[model samples]
Target chain A: MRKVAVIGAGMTLFRRRLLETGKEMCFQAVQMALEEAGLELKDVDAVVSGSAPDAFDGVHMKGEYLLDGAGGVRKPYMRVFTGGGTACFSPIAGWWHVASGLADVVLVVNEEKMSSITPHPQYAFANIWDPILDRPLKPNLVWIFAMEMNRYMTVYGIEKADIARVAVKNKRNAVDHPAAQLADPNITVDDVLNSEVMAWPVQRLDISPPSDGASALVLASEDVARQVSETPVWISGVGWCIDSTMWTNRDLSFPEYLARAAQQAYGMAKIENPRKEVDVVEPYDPFDYKELHHLEGLLLADKGEAPILTREGVTQRDGELPTCPSGGLMGVGNPIAATMGIKTGEIYWQLAGKAGRRQVPGSPQVGVCQAWGDLMQFSSVMVMRA
Target chain B: MVGEEYRRWEGDMEALYVYTAGVAGDRFFREIRDNERLMGTYCPECDVTYLPPRLYCETCFSELNEWEEIPNKGRVDAITVAYVDDKGERLARPKVLAMVRFLGANGGLIHVVDLPEEDVYRGMEVEVVYLPRGLRKGSFLDILHFKAI
Candidate 1:
C-alpha cells in the first residue's frame, strides 16, 4: 500500500452563529489549509467533502451546493456522510485516494452549519429516528444521550460527580484552543452537576452546543508529503463500522460498533496494546460520558474502568495519556462533521507538536482520533503518527 | 461574503415519511389487542428476547417466531423530565419520560411515566397502564404509558 500523510490542517472558529454561509466557511477552511500546505486549487487532484444531515443546513443536495466553495469545482468531489462520523471518514476516504495511487494530492473539506436551522438543531435530530418504531415517541436528542449515560452509570455504578469531571476537564482544557466555543477555565464538577438538566443525566454543560464551522485537511502521497511538509503526520491506520439499525436490540452501555472499528484500526496499525503505545488520544466527546465511553471502546481503558482513570488524572492534557487537549466537542463546539477540527486536525497538530498551549509536554509519536454518529450506530477511527 | 444582513428566505421541508409495521410488529399489535399483554420476539438461536418484537434476530440473521410474554412490571432504567416537545416548544408542564426495562427482555419501552419528576428515579418499579379494551386501537398507543408502582 502506498503511504499517505496529512500535510496541512486548518479550521474556523466554532460558534453558535456565524455570519458566513456554509459555502463561505468551506472556502475559509480550504483556503487556509491550502495556504499552509503552500499549494493552490490547481494543484489538487481530487476532493472529498464531508457534511452531515441536510436537515440542519435546511438545504437539499448540500454537497453539490458547497462543491465549488470547497475547491472541488470540476474535480472528483465526493460527499460522504456517516452522520457525525463523517469527519474521520472524510480523511479515511482521502487516505485511500492517495494510497490507491489514484490521486497524489487529495483535499478533504468538512463543514456543518447547524445555525441555519430554526429554533434549534435538535429539530433536525428528530428525523434521524425510525419513523415506524421510534419516531412516534418524538424523542429529544438529549433523551437518547441521557438514556445511554444513565445505563452506563447504572451498570458501572458510576457517580454523577465522577462523570461531571469529564465536562470540567474538557472545557477547561479548551482555554488554549483558539477555535473553542465554551472554553471555561473556571468550570467545576459542581457547575456541571448543577447545570440545567436537559435530560436527567445530561446537563447543559455536559453537552456540546451546536455550532457553525468548517475544517480542512490536505492529504498527499509520500513523495508529495515530503516536498510539501517538513513535519508530515502519516496516516497509519483507518477503520469504521455501523451497528444494527434497531438501536434497541443492542446494549447501550457499551459502544460495540466503535469497539469493532478500533479493533480493525489497531490491527492495521499493528498496535498490540493501545493503552501503552498510543502517546496521545482524542475520542469524540460530544458529551462528557462519550470520552470515557470511546476510550473503553478503543481498548485504551478496561471495560467499565474509564471513569476511574479519568478521575485519577490519567486522561488529563499533561497526564500520562493526554486526551482531548483540544477541549473536544464539549469545549471546542460540535459542528457535526466539521468537528474534524478536533478529531483529525487536532491529532495532526498534536503529532506535529504544533498544538501550542494545548500541546502535551513530551514529543508524542502516535495518536488516535475517533468519531461517532447516526442513531449511535456509526463509528469511525483513524490512527496517525509522526 | 456575508454582509450585516444578507438576502435570506425561510421555508419548511416538504417531505413526508411513511412507515410500515413489519412481520413481528403486526403480530405484536394484534396480540396486544387480543390479550392486553406485552410480547417479545425470542430469538431461539441467540436466546435473546427482543422486547419490541422483530421478525429477525439481531445477532443471527435467522428468522424468529417464538413469542415470549414480557412481565408488565419493570424497573425504570432512566427518566428524563422533558419541558419541550419535538418542535422545541415548551410544554405547560414537564413530562416525565422513563425507559422501562422489563425483566428478561433485551430492549425496553420509552414512554411517559405517570409520576412526578422527583419521584421518577431509576430502579423505581413501574407497571404498564393499558387503555380500556373498547378504546384499544391495536397499536403501541394501546399501553398509554407506564405508571409508578
Candidate 2:
C-alpha cells in the first residue's frame, strides 16, 4: 500500500446556530482545506463526505444534495456514516482512496447542521434507540449517558468529582481554542457538580451542547503530499469496529468495542505501548465520562484509571499525554458528525506545531484520535505521526 | 436602509410504521397477554438468557427458539428520577425509572418503577406488578410498575 498523508485541515466556528446551510458550511470548510493545501477545487480527484442521520438536517440522501458544495462536481464522490465516528472514519475512507492508487488527492469533508432540527437539538437524538423497546420508555438522550455513567461509576467506585474534573479541564482548555463554543476558563469542579442535573450522573455541564459546524481534511498520496505540505502528518494506521446494537447486553463500564478498534490501529502502527509511544491523544468526548471511558478504551490508561490521571492534571493541555488539547467536543461545539475539528484537525495542528495556544508541551511525535458512535456500538481510530 | 428577510422553512413529517413483532417478539408479547409470566430466549450456545428476547442470539446470531419463563422479579442495575417528560414539561411527581435485570438474564427491561428515591439503590430487588389480566394490551406497559418485593 502507498503512504497517505494529511496535507491540510480546516473547520468552521462551531456554534449553536449557523445561518449558513449545510452545503454552505461544507463549502466554507472545503475552501479553507483547499487553500491550505494550495490546490484548486479542480485539482481534487475524489470527494469523501461524512455526516450522520438525515433526521438532524431533515434531508434524506443528504450526500447527493451536498455534492456540489463539497467540490465533487463531476468527480467520484461517496458518503460514509458510522454515527459520531463519521468524523474520524471519513479520513480513513480518504486514506484507502490514496493508499490503493484510487485517487491522488482526496478531499474529506464532514458537516452537521444540528440546529436545523426544531424544538431542542436533543430531540433528534431520541431516534438513536430502538423504537419498539427503548422508545416506549420515552427516553431523552441524557438518560442513556447518565445510566452508563452510573454503571461505570458504581463498578469502579469512581467519585462524581473525579468525573466532573474532566469537564473542568476540557472546557477550560477550550478557552484557547478558536472554534470552541463552550469554552470557559473559570469553570470549576464545583460549578460542574452544582450545575443543572439533566440526569443524575450527567448534568448540563457534563455534556457538550449540540452545534452546527463543518470540518475538512485534504488527504493525498506520498508524492502529492510532499508537494502540497512541507510537514505532512502521515496516516500510520486506521481502524474501526462496531459492537452489538443491544446495548444493555454488555457491561457499560468499559468500552470493549473501542478497545478492539484501538488495538487494530495500534497494531498496524506497531505501537506496543500507547502510553509510552503516543504523545498527544484525542478520544471522542461528547460527554466528560466518555473522554475518561475512551482513554481506557485506547489503552492510554488502565481500566478505571483515567479519572485518576485526570485528577493529577496529566490530561491538561500542557501535561503529559495531553488529551483533547483543542478543548474537545466538550469545549468545542459537538456538531455530532463534524467533531473531526478536534479528533483529526486538532491532532494535525499539534503535529504541525500550529495549534497556537492549545499546542501540547514539547516536540510531539505521535498522536491517536478516536470517536464512538451509533448507540454505543461503533468505534473508529486513527494513528498519525509527524 | 431596509433589512432583507431570509426564508427559514420548517416542517415536521409524522412517520408511523407498523413494525412486525417477528417470531421471537410475537411469542414474547403473546405470553405477556395470554399468561401473566415474562418470557426470555435462552441461547444454548452461550448459556445466557436474554430478557426482551430476540429471534437470533446477539453474540453468535444463532436462530434461537428455546424460551424460558424467567422470574418476574429482578435487581435494579440503575435507577433514574426524571423531573420532566419528553416534551420538557415538568411532571407533578418525578418518575422513578429503573433498568431491571431478571434473574440470570443477560439483558433487562427499562421501566418506571414504584419506589421511593431514598429507598432506591443499585442491586435492590423489585417485582413486576402486571396490569389486571383484563387490562393486558400485549404491550410493554402491560406490566405497570416493578414494585418493591
Candidate 3:
C-alpha cells in the first residue's frame, strides 16, 4: 500500500438539536475540510460518506441523497456502514483509495441526524432486532446494552462507582472541545448512580446524548500530501472486522470484534505490543462502560484488567495509556458516524501537537482510533504515526 | 446554483430491503408465541452460542442446529427514558427502553420495561413478559415489555 496522509479536518458543532438539514451539515463540513486542505470541490478525486441507519434520517438510499452535499456529484463515491463504526470506516475507505492507486485525493464525510427522528432514535433500532423472534419480545434497544453492562460488571467485578469514573473523566475532557455538546457537567459517581435508570444496569448519565452533526477529513497520497500541508498525519495501517450478528451466541463481557480488528491494524502497522507501542488511544465510548470494554478489546489492557487500569488512573489523560483524550463519544456527543471522525480528527491534532487543553504531556509519536458497533458485531481500527 | 423554484423535486421513490433469516430469530419468536422460553443456537465448532438467535455459526462456518433455553432472569445492562419519538419530536412523556442480558446468555435482548421510569438501573433483575395469547400479532411488539421479577 502506498503512503496516505490526512491533510485537513473539519466538523460541525455537535448539538442535541440542529435546525439545519442533514445535507446542509455535510456541505458545511466538507467545504471546511477542503478549504483547510487548500483545495476546492473540484480537487477531490473520490468521496466516501457514512451514516448509520436510514431509518433515523427517514430517508432511504441515504448515500445517493447525500452525494452532492458530500462533493460526490459526478465523481467516484461510495457509502459504507458497519453500524456505529461508520465514522472510522469512512477514513479507512479513504486510506484504500490512495493505497490501491484508485484516487489520489479522497474526501471522507460522515453525518448522523439522530434528532430528525421522532419518539426516540431508540425506536428505529427496534427493527434492527430479529423481526421474527426477538422483535416479538417487544425489546427496546437499551435491553441488549443493559445485559452487556451487567455481564461486564459481573465478570470484571466492577462497581457502579468504577463505571461512573469514565463519565466524569470524559465529560471533564469535553470542556475544552469546541464542538462537544455534553462537554460541561460537574458529575460524580453518585451523580451517575442517582440518575434515572433507563434500564437495570444503565442510568441516564451513563449514555451519551443523541446528537446531530457532520465531520469531514481529506486524505492525500504521499506526493499530494507533501504539497498540501506541512504537518500531515500519516496513516500507517487500517483494519476492520465484523463478528457474528448472532450477538447472543458469544461472550458479551468483552468485544472480541475489536480485538480482531486491532490485531489486523497492528500487524499492518508492525507493532508488537499495542499497550506499549501506541502513545495515545481512542476507543469508541457511546456508554461509559464501553470505554473500558473496548480498552481490553484493543489490547491496551488484558481482558478483565481494563477496569483495574482505569481505576488506577492508568488510562487517564496524564496516565500511562491516555485513552479518549478527545472526550470520546461519551463526552463529545455521538451523532453516529460523526463520532468516529472526532476520534480521527483528534488524533490528527494530537500528532501535530495541536491539542491545546487535552494534550498529552509528551509529544505523542503514535495513536490509535477504534470504533465498535452493529450490536457489537463490527469493529474498525486505524493506527497513525507522526 | 439553481434557484429555489428550480431546486424543488417532484417525483416518487420506491425502495426495498431483503434479508436472510439469521441464527435465532425464528425459534426465538416461535418459542415465545408457544409460551416457551428461548435463547440462542450454539455451535460446538466455534464454541459460541447466540442469543437473539441465528442460522449459522460465524466463526466455525457451521450451520447452527441447537436452540438452547436460558433463564429469563438477568441484570440490566443499560436503560433510557427517551422523551422523543424516532422523528425527534417530543412526546407527552418518555418511554423506557432497557438492554437486558439473561443469565448464561452471550448477549442481551432489548425490550420495553413495565417498571416505572424512575425504578430502572444497570443491575436490576427483569423477566420476560409475553403478550396475551389472543393479542399475539407475530411481531416484535407481542411482548409489551419486561417487568421486575
iRMS of each prediction: 19.5, 18.8, 19.6
lDDT agreement of model 2 with the native: 0.86
Model 2 lDDT per residue over B89-120, tens place: 99988999999988888889989888678888
Interface RMSD of 1: 19.5
Per-model chain A TM = 0.99, 0.99, 0.98
Give the per-residue Cα lDDT of candidate 2 at B50. Answer: 78
Clashing pairs counted in every model: 0, 0, 54
lDDT of 3 by residue, A1-386 (tens): 79999988888889887755676677778777877788877778889998898987777888998776677877888999888988789899989999999999999999888876675777677778876567767788888989999999998788888888888888888887888888865767788889999998999989998988999999999999998788889999788999888888988988877888999999999999888899998888999999988888888888778778878998888999888988888888999898865789888878878788889879999999988788778989999998
Query: TM-score for all predictions?
Result: 0.73, 0.73, 0.72
lDDT of 1 at A226: 96
Provide chain B TM-scores across all predictions.
0.90, 0.92, 0.83
Candidate 2 segments whose C-alpha is farther than 4 A from its true place: B1-149
Candidate 1 clashing pairs?
none
Better of 1 and 2 by lDDT: 1
Writing each residue's lDDT as its tens digit, candidate 1 over A1-386 gives: 99999988889999998766677677778877888888877789999999999888877898997786688877888999998999799999999999999999999999998877777786788778666566667678788889999999999899998888889999999999999999998999999988998889888888999998999999999999998899899999999999998877889989999989999999999999898899999999999999999999999998789999999999998899999989999999999999998999999999988889989988999999999998888899999999
DockQ score for candidate 1: 0.01
Off by over 4 Å in 1: B1-149
Question: Which digits, one per residue and each the tens of the lDDT, describe model 2 over residues A1-386?
Answer: 99999988889899988766677677778878878888877678899999998878877898987776677768899999999999799999989999999999999999888877777765677777677677777778788889999999999999999999988888989999888899998999999999998989889899999988899999999998887689899999899989888988988999999999999999999999889999999999999999999999999999999999999989887789899998999998799889997899889889988888988978799999999898878899999999
The residue-level lDDT of candidate 2 at A279 comes to: 96
